[model samples]
Target: MVLPNLNWRAFIRSQPINIMSRSFAAIFAGYLVAATGSGLLALIIPLPASQSVLIAMMLSFSFYVAAAIWAFSVGTSRQAWRDLLLISAILYIFILWVS
Candidate 1:
């Protein structure tokens, strides 16, 4: 059996967050969602280490935001959008507290 190789870095760079796409509406929406989420948590959660957990939470949560924006832009239903946002919020909280 033959398997196709995947280039993960290339795939990731193609995402909305990449600098070249920063002005794209979807990318902007993802950033807005991520920033809003981070701000809310920063208000509720006590600050901790700056380098590791905090940064990781920001990065991962941003990706979740990007994925969500992509999903909604592709005509995902309102229910799906709600579910994805809820799941991402939960995941962000879990990561913030556990890490």
Candidate 2:
């Protein structure tokens, strides 16, 4: 059996933008979908919802800000931005789930 050795450094340098763009798009799209869905749920599912209009707006803003940061962070610290997006998304979901 032959094992392939993947060189991460070379891979990272070879397609920085590709990785960043895909990460950014995925994060952005995922957040947008969640936010939109939350908005719809907020309207439809009424039951002492913890998410107020102000909170929802804030979350929406945070998603946009994260995406803008992700765009700028590319070619500089793609990994850091990628982690940020992931963490933010997770936090958003956690909040939605808990609250």
lDDT of each residue in 34-79, candidate 2, tens digit only:
4764564455444565655556555666555665555556555555
For residues 7-66, write the lDDT of model 1, one tens digit per residue.
Answer: 877865664534334334344445545664554455456557454447646665766566
Show where candidate 2 strays beyond 4 Å: 1-51, 74-81, 96-99
Runs in model 1 deviating more than 4 A are 1-23, 47-60, 63-99
Query: Best candidate per TM-score, number?
Result: 2
lDDT of 2 at 62: 59
Candidate 2: give the clashing pairs.
none
Clashes of each: 0, 0
Question: Ten consecutive residues with minimal summed lDDT in candidate 1?
Answer: 17-26
